[model samples]
Target chain A: MTDGIPAAPGTDAWFHDGPDGFVLLAGRCTACGALSFPPRPIPGCPNPDCDGLEQHPHALSTTGSLWSYTDARYVPPPPYPRPPDTEFSPYALAAVELDAERMIVLGQVAPGVAVSELTVGMPMRLVPGVLVSSAGVEERVWNWRPGA
Target chain B: MSRPDSVAVLGVGMHPWGALGKSFVEYGLVAARAALADAGIGWRDVQLVVGGETIRNGYPGFVAGSALSQALGWQGAPVASCYAACATGAQALSTARAHILAGLADVVLVVGADTTPKGFFAPVGGDRPDDPDWLRFRLLGATNPAYFGLYARRRMAIRGTTEADFAAVKVKNARAGSLNPYARFRAEVDAETVLNSPMVSDPLRLLQICATSDGAAAVVLASEEYARRKQRDAVRIRAISAITPEYPRTVPDFPYLASDSAAISPPASRTFRESLAWSAYESCGLGPEDMDLAEVYDLTTAMELDWYEEIGLCAAGEAEKLLHDGATALGGRVPVNASGGLSSFGEAIPAQAIAQLCELTWQLRGDAGTRQVAGARAGVAVNQGLFGHGAAMVVAHA
Candidate 1:
């Protein structure tokens, strides 16, 4: 519980610091054993047939392989809190394959990692980072760093 | 698939795709009036009007159907507005068809127009945590081009597609665009120019991606019986399919942070884009080999290659080969984007899908002067919008 480190204000349900460190939160259906991320109150499973009404909170895998990657060279418009164009720098994004969940999750790559350093199938691990810092309050977010 | 009764496209009109500083209504009116005149029918003869809604304009754009009807001097026609991102025009056509088939109205006018804002299209205002569109921008700063870049990079890694293959798409489409007066970018581009352009996203240069433009398109559709009565030789719409991706969708589409986990249910046999084409083919009782021409959404040069496979024009991973063989050129077996595609026309959001059909209608009628495909009989238009909205239409000469 450090000042600069907290689950991104409203996204606490999606990511949290587990015993092993940052892990994605998910929901597992008790009836059909289906797993989904961004935990939701269950009365339904994404599966059409299974009448799975009950779901319990589950922690997702912390590491995954890079499925794909790209860099945002242009400044995204409003609501993104982008810095002025002159001070803007591109950041890399990675789509990681969470093998356990059998799904691909997207996130920004850890700061300072250029696009050239990344490759498909490269190992990546989830970690906490700052989305934005304002008025002494740091809005925490998740980043995928190159590692196991 | 059972054949639904076909609808006849009596007329097609468009306000040229460019950065025209005009309101959406003005554009819509121009296209609508031209379509009505082309059909040899008065505006008052139209019984129903369907409009593709634009997200840029606040209240007026939202109620586009009524707003456009009002601008055209409301004759008490029932109005409906639809929003489906870039597929908005196709959805509006679908709505008009539903009315025509249900015996609600015989003649319906469909219009779509947009005055796109400059720069990257951002999410609507506010910090509503529930909105995924806002979250992607706020959390990852992922612009639309970023998503396109990710897909492009994935295609290269998986299929070994080269940068030259992508530049070829621009060259071919731009050549066709030069012949199209409605297209914004009329000059043909070379591979060298595309390669030298500034990189908007990795593996994609400025020339490779479509720019946002202000444009409008309109089409007048009438029942088969009505067309016969009017003695109008019109392009017939055999089928229009608007299909969404099924559950356990493995591919991460735009505006979504994560794809549905395949841990529970397996992904569908066919990809989303493939399903869209299949639905159109099944409904029309026709396959890719039967099509004389096609108009596909080329938001990016790489995307056009992907569409070649999705629409069954070529086998999977063979899109680059199709391009290499000149199979997709104007004189090839099946010409694609004869209307210059989004690469030349850019994107007008709501108007894009309708503009695709306009190209098909003209091509099928042998009226596409300079860019005409020889003796074109059947044509298809395919487009996919954000949030799983996929659309395809089959048009044939009557």
Candidate 2:
């Protein structure tokens, strides 16, 4: 295993280690209280009645319900972190619905998990995981793990 | 019934779909010329040309309108290009219809074609991670099939749908495809064949998913008065619903990692896919009952079932039941994809929506050969793309 220090890529700045645990960065509409993930250039509130645009940084809940799940049964196309020397491995993916935010966010299931083991509406929690590691760094990402 | 805004589909044509190993422009030109000949008009007779774009082909594909015009000898016809991912063909058709409806042109030619690369379509070569398409593959290793798999699984959980039900869809489409001369895969497949095929995504097999293909389709659309001069009757495009999703969309769609939070604002009364055909039906004063046939995008056998419900063929969660009853098969009450759908043609991208219109044209004109929908009078063609782009069109005898 790569012992490199953990770091987040520029595009994955939303993944953060909060005091309590792993939390996804989101935005809360200052006016209408709308919530959005990866909240840069915070989008306008989705509510048609509200014209509010300004949103402040907010942390999303770490736990949610599994809305759906599947797996990459075949080798995916490039830019999917396949080092030329490594063999492809199928992995499970899940869409978790954050109850508080009332939004569904997609993420990889924790390693070793399979689609057969997951069911819709089951409880899941966010956990820190390494997306890929190279050179002297471990690129970190969030994974959805089964159980509360 | 033909409304005041209806535009006549004077002629339609297509190049056979397959890995023909030819340039996209070449395929488009052949189909365009074929449509012109079928319309009994010369190239110079056209007033406008609309091209559905294919970004994979680089600069020429991006500006396909001008490229096709140049390839056709540049008669100085006014041209426009449209790009809306899988909905490109529909967008191009919509542009041509608008030009005719607004009386900007008496005769317009619409064309779309593509030469897809092998295997899964990857995002354009780049290092920038801002693209959701790139991020999905990089972060989650989620291919297009992954999303389809997700939707399929969700449907199974909610509706008690089974793998056999999904395989049955492929069987039906493959049976129809066998009769379509233009289809790439012309051999009929059985449910067992579909089920036994190697799995590309869990609960979805290789035979159940459409392949990326190289093909082209074209149509000549003209004003009602112009069409009347040459023909006693014509197939008229009654409506084209090129629409987008509403705010706070709760369902997860392609190329998006997160769905809008509906906690603050309630979800729309109709989901995005449902609204597509709804808008078309409202515009044309038509309903699901009025449709004699349909040509829906069958990206996956499972997605086709979804379209049946979204298009109001049946109530929610009733598509599986409808399929088993053979209501959507040829000789049934409302035959769908009588032209074999994407299951046969694979996906020519830009050419697909126009191809759907071509199938509707032939069926409405009583010209479809072996795969004809008997006495078909009215039909609907529907498809959706990434990032909230969707299109649904209604066609009827004028």
Candidate 3:
């Protein structure tokens, strides 16, 4: 697999390629075991009772169930950068609920997927996909696809 | 309930909503003058002014209270500005009510206005990658409607809701809006028009989603004693809930990329949307049964249905049944959005919540000519903004 450029600031910081597949990075409170995404430093654990300031990097589940799905049929205005020389086309999006994490993560659906093909509670797996490409370089991001 | 502490709503007014090709200051001043006239008072009578801030405009928009006050021939009144995305107007009202109830101010003016550009609302200009609003657009090309569409599809999948059911909401709101002179789209549309409208986000048609509009609304609020002194019958604000979400929020809201992980800690029992109205009801010692009407944020037709359950007007997954039963239409058991909602007046951001209050005031006063809810004794308005801003208010006839 080829490494691609991170699409947003702090993007490269929170995700990476793992032995199994792509995984999202999160901050786990060392004391109370609470998890936060984008791995940013918060004042402390979200738990009001816990004053735990220590945290460690934790990997998130790569597979989940589809919570909901939609397709954006209109072209979004900037700062949404469109690919060079390509006409605008509708793209599907999904909110997938990670079973173990017990949280919802949103992502673009795989390239060929359509809204009609998706269903709520159906199993979905995350895979590396390109958000945009220019000058022989691809902007890598995670995508949800129906599978184990 | 031991008479919940309240503030008297003396008067309310609005600038007709549409692309009026005017400045935010213009709309705000017009609405302010109308409200002051309705209250039968001069600008000098107001002890304080609270303005809902508009982020889209420049520096003056951020300090809207000062701008409106300067426009209204400054009386040197104390002023405050509030910003909470879509909930800005509610926050402004909450601020005004707080001052009146605190004995620091006797009469307060609350105003909100915006002159929005056409098309989807984009993040403010810049390459700030740390900003989630900008990142959502840059990374996923997700517009606000994309989030609404997701919610609509989720409801359909889980609750057996249909596209036609959503269309009915638009049809209902449009008919109500037709009677509202200040609404943007005052022409009623049929279910066919809504169903056939081009899809902006799958499951949400162009007609189903609200447009960006230029508008303003203002209200005059005073202490109950002041109202009694004036010998005026006024609406009383029973409660204002500007609560934020609790910890371990599980549902995905707008602008946020992900929900808080409940892997270790259990999730909050009530969703953030539900909690907004819950706090208002709890504070006022009122329940859904006490409401004669409701003016909920209908950013999309589907969201109107969601508010039904969130505000406890109906049980979860039963909004469709309530709609079919005609319980939420004008002249029904309890009308919702009798002022046409966002379906008729698109969103003017900071102005919306204040506009909802204006409708409630008119209805309770029996001044809403054609679309009035019969003998509306109590009402509620609820809306949530990007991030965790939750706004809700309950008002009763005084």
Per-residue lDDT for B183 in model 3? 95
> Rank by lDDT, descending?
3, 2, 1
Docking quality category of candidate 3 according to DockQ thresholds: medium
Which lDDT tens digits does candidate 2 get at residues B248-322? 888889888889899888888999999999999999899999999999999999999999999999999999989
Superposed Cα deviation of residue B238, candidate 1 (Å): 0.8
Question: For model 2, what is the error of residue B345's alpha carbon versus the real structure, in angstroms, after optimal superposition?
Answer: 0.8
lDDT by residue (B195-214, candidate 3, tens digit) is 99999988999999999999
As for candidate 1, its clashing pairs are none
| Model 2: DockQ vs. true structure | 0.72
lDDT minimum window of 10 residues, candidate 2 chain A: A1-10
Per-residue lDDT of model 1, residues A1-148, tens digit only: 3354665544757766655677777778888877776565336887777887887778888899999999888877867764333366688999999998888889999889999999998999998877653233457788899999
Candidate 2: tens digits of C-alpha lDDT, residues A106-128: 99999999888999999999988
Task: List ranges where model 1 is wrong by over 4 Å.
Answer: A1-4, A41-43, A83-86, A133-136, B1-4
Go through the candidates in order and give each one's C-alpha lDDT: 0.87, 0.88, 0.89
